[model samples]
Target: MEPKNNEEEWGKTAWEFLTQVRTQSPLIQCITNFVSMDLMANTLLSAGASPAMLHSLPEIPHFTPRADALLINLGTLSPSWLPSFNSAAELCHSLGTPWVLDPVAVSASPFRFNACLELLRFKPAVIRGNASEIIALSMPQHSTTDSTKGADSTHESTDAVEAAKLLAQRTGAIVAVTGATDIVTDGNQVVGARNGVALMQKITATGCSVTALIAAFVAVDKSHALDATVSALAVFGVAGELGMKEAKGPASLRMHLIDALYGLDEAALKSHVNITSLC
Candidate 1:
């Protein structure tokens, strides 16, 4: 489906998705990293969704089916975490539950690169990552190494737009490449969300948390995965901007960001969101 070209319409769509998430409170099963677990869960809860950070092989079988959506983040991957990650993804595929993949620093390690390729077999509904990660994931060889400084992106978001488009076409999944200007595409349509502050990069797990938030939005509305992703990112961007207003630094911004998300409403979105459909 083509996203609305006008900013006002897109803002309304975003607002509707946010309100739906609050009303539905979808249960999101997130198999995320240890570093981001606390913040990711808090981000979801603040945005009005139930989050479960369960990543055990035995428990996933029972939990995957019950979840409205699933998130797999390969930030702190370990040999032991593989079983649970694979199990949860497999169950999510079988149950036809929408899932989001955050291939954090996939280009930084061979294990993460190989693991991401393996998970692609299950077909994630959305793939969220930084520029370098997306570029690495979309390469034909899947062996082309890109520069990734830890979990930070070495490439700009604009540099990955074509890669993201190609990845979306190949995997049939909505792709989100986040940076200063976040981009979301579903192969056919593309949108850019410019509403965040630079201070957002100072805080850890904000990007990872956004991936989980995308999962929550997808759970509430699967048909418009592209819209859900764009909406979520826009909301995050707006919140980041609002948070910067009163924040003294990264430390304070982190606290204010969650507060902004909890207080986000249609009026704020309509007024603050700067969204544009590229296609």
Candidate 2:
């Protein structure tokens, strides 16, 4: 998954998107898992975006309208919380505020999996998840065999490329499968972000944090969902690659990663970003 000769072009494009995010400082409404709330908010702030972890259903009318973008993550799905998510997403649809969906561990159960499918009705701007989750989401709605997995993906990110494409085609959303090589697709063009350190996987909520970051990126762009999604992932990966240099372990890497994202300059981004077209 080495970048082609056009790496510089993609790097600059990504940097341009990040610049837009900083300029806009889009207020992102995130209805995410409790465990990820802190890290996700920190990730958005480090990237120069405002994050609002508002989930109360009553606030949807006022906040959702003002938010530049929204993130609905099923990482901590509950029967009680699904309606608020539905309400928020529906409002985002009506207001045309781009929203992202992170269907964490969709195969773990029936209720959580069905909740993810239901959210697809509004047609999210982007869908980010692991390979197994992507594979599960792309499966026939009636299938029963693709069950029993935890949040962790059983397969490699590359294994779900076809599924990711299929999902994007069916749902009309840019689908991103995150793993060693983060894959982004729009049912046509498939892009792979070859950045980040393997140690990133050890940190809890990194995936959730990245999804929120994607929400921030698309909040600023809104038109080029695929490019925005790729850029967010690549930028996060570049931050991870840089943070790994001074990190003693997963704990320190977490702090350093946020700092790297906060301090990323044109030079480091242009030199380190490795996004490429995937066959």
Candidate 3:
């Protein structure tokens, strides 16, 4: 086995895996919020994946079976969407379909907290969140530093590594914590993804869209769920880094970011990714 101390070796496979997802054009079903729908849909399409927004309870079970992978984002959850979300999760569970969970603002309210807890019962293949969100989900006693109330992170990714690992162990899922430096773990091993721009947080819906991207990869590659999760995060991060150089602000960065994702290639990822320590 290679040394985990070396940061050079860890992100290699992850970068390659993401390139494949963009080239394969997998179908990913997203049960995300309205605030992120436009950006998330465009992001998925830009990454060469088909996107489907499925929210109605009457149609979710039918749609879940047809989807390659399912992404559930609790960003703007509503009472009406609850039944559909639960039904879709159950269908995905029963059908052996891989799914990702984005506990957006999980630390903000009792409704979200309970919803995430219930979703955990279905056993998501991957769980992605920011530092405060991850810490809240995995270690409820930990104090939250994020100031956006229901939308952002004030803490760095490194701060949530332990919580992410704990959550991964408890759920038997891959946990991805994003911030200045992204960290992904699967209970025993941790992979740090060093390929994003700080300006990404300045834009809205970047995290929610990346969650969908992970679902796209998981659709085709379930055996290496952690790899898929890390790959998607790294790929998205790298695109953001590139997009920032040409962006004027958050709005411009969002469009440029999508273009960068559409233009992403293996060569670009190889040259730009700064990740290390893959165990």
Candidate 4:
């Protein structure tokens, strides 16, 4: 399938998902690191999705299948979190609930690097990362540098497209590479969502929060994971673009971004969105 066809199909499906979010608020179980907790939870709420931070082994197993989606972020990996992560992933798989993965700093530590590979065994529905993280996740040998020390990407979004495609092919997951311009793929197709501000990188926790948002969309609309990922990216990026214009800096921009997301509608998307379809 070509990128244009994928974009067209995803576009319609995304709108369907937006309607679903408005009607049925899905509960999202997030076993993410502590760094992104506030931004992620608030973003999910603004987008009409419920979010819970459930990381304990006992709690995660009980909640994983009941929630609409399970989102795991390996930002601050600890040995204690491993059992919970694995058990929740297994429950999601057994219950047929979709899940999203964010390999935050897989390149830095041997523990996180191997842990990410282990997470792949669960077959994530969507994978979200920046350039280096995506590159490292796809081919660890080629990208030895870690991207978790800072939220900013050292590589352009375009540079990671191939890596995203490769990872998607290997895992059968929708891959989202976010940078100056976000590129999302499912091995055979690509959709570029070009509507964010450079200020997005300056803000802390944006990428991790975006990952959680993607999971929320995917949980509500599992039939089209690519569309769910793209919609989440596009909507969040568009909000950033709009929010930066009126805000003073990263601090104010973060608050305004949430307002912008809550303010987003079909009218705003039709005029403000700048995504291009390319295969």
Candidate 5:
């Protein structure tokens, strides 16, 4: 395999991906939790993509097929919602539309754990989650007895690199574990991005919002999924970094982050993107 070690080469494409989203205005259908609707929609809108917060089974036949990409976030997972998630995944897989999975607190319960594994069979274009979520998700066969603290990560992002790689291999999807330094991998290759400010972590649904960002990025370039996933993280980080410059706290950071994302120019993307090959 060719080496992806050149940092500048990896970093430059961030603008291309951002530009494509602005030009294409891909429609991203998000089947996310209640808490994330507002932030996630704003995140996609700021990145110049349309966000559709639709998750009803009735609309799957008509709506999901037409979406440029789909995002299935298992944040507020329940038995009633499983059918909708499954129907959308099956539709997206059949149509070859890039879809992303955000398995929030995936191992928090046995029910949610099994649901994630079932969705993996549909082959999402990307799977984005935190270290604890990735680590728990990587073990597909193990029982859902793993004690993962709900929503928050007990482990650092670096600690889940191996697990992320293994999950990518198993699922045939780009695996991204977000933390201080976001990690992206496609089983054989790994990329790292360091740009977001620390304060962004304190905000609610930031992870969920970034997952939608990943979906939007991949939606624009379904063929180059690895690059798209990395670009999304780096771009989001750059926005957080810029937003932090004027942010007073997580609340202000959240607001400024959307503003930064909406206003990102090529210069900002070029100067702030920090993606590099980890291997």
Candidate 6:
């Protein structure tokens, strides 16, 4: 079947996902970095999802089974964090729970790249990252990689569209490449969301928090992983744009972004989302 590019349908779908998330209030287990933990949790709360920062191996089995979804982010890759990530991912897989992987700065170090490769075995429902990390993850030929500058993408989002598609095909996961214009693909169908502002980049952990939001949406409806992922990005992008209008700068933008997300309802999502399918 050919992919349809209907803006109205996209908006309706996004609004539906947003409404489901707000009603469901899914519990998201996040094994994210320290830098992103607080903001990610706040973002989840503002979006009407329960956030649990449980990254200890001892508690992995206990939490993984109860959570709606899991998020593994390699932002602060420490020696102790690896075992917990592996355990949570394995448990989530065995329990048939959806999970997301945010390979932050995966292109920067061999350790991070190798860890991501290992995690791919369990299969994540979604992989959210910048263009550099997605490109590095897609290309297995490269040995010493370098496409990021300390968790920041050095490349444009367009540069990783093909890589994201290939990665999604190989992993059977939705790939979301976030930048000036966010792109989401599930190997066959591609979607683009153009509804964010430059101020988003200045705030730390916006990308990571967005991934957590994706987990929440996916938890609500795992069967439609692509749509859920795209909806999460569209919601975040729309909130960013709305936040920018009231923000003085990066600091204020962060606060306003969270507020905007909290204020976002079905009506706001249906009207503000600028999404289209791209086959």
Winning candidate number (TM-score): 1
* Tens digits of per-residue lDDT for model 4, 1-279: 223454445455555666677678899999988988999998889888898988988677566778999999998889999998888888888888999999886777677879989888999999999887898889845344445454446678899989999999999999999888889999988888887898887777899999988998898779778878888887788789888888998899999999988777776655666667777
Q: What's the CA error at residue 234 for candidate 3, in Å?
A: 1.2
Pull out the clashing pairs in model 3.
Answer: 7-276, 7-277
Off by over 4 Å in 2: 1-5, 142-144
Q: Candidate 3 or 6, higher lDDT?
A: 6
Evaluate model 5: give its lDDT: 0.91
Model 6, residue 19: distance off in Å is: 1.0
- For all candidates in order, the CA lDDT equals 0.91, 0.92, 0.82, 0.83, 0.91, 0.89
- lDDT for position 46 in model 3: 88
Deviating ranges (above 4 Å) for candidate 3: 1-12, 140-148
Measured with C-alpha atoms, the lDDT of residue 250 in candidate 5 is: 93
Candidate 2 or 4, higher TM-score?
2
lDDT of 5 by residue, 1-279 (tens): 244566666667888889999999999999999999999999999999999999999999999988999999999898999999999999999999999999999888888889999999899999999999999999855455666788989889999999999999999999999999999999988888998988888999999999999999999889999989888999999999999999999999999999999999988778777877878
- Candidate 1 RMSD to the real structure: 1.0
Candidate 2 vs candidate 3, lDDT winner = 2
Native RMSD of candidate 5 (Å) = 1.4
What is the C-alpha lDDT profile of model 3 across 7-78, one tens digit per residue?
344456655666666678788889999889999999899888899997878787566798888999998888
Give the C-alpha miss distance for residue 272 in model 2, angstroms: 0.5
TM per prediction:
0.98, 0.96, 0.91, 0.93, 0.97, 0.96
Residues 34-90 of candidate 6: C-alpha lDDT, one tens digit per residue: 999989999999999999998878988776899999999999898778888899999
| Per-residue lDDT of model 1, residues 142-256, tens digit only | 5644677888988999899999999999999999999988889988788888889998999989999999999999999998899999999998889999989999999999999
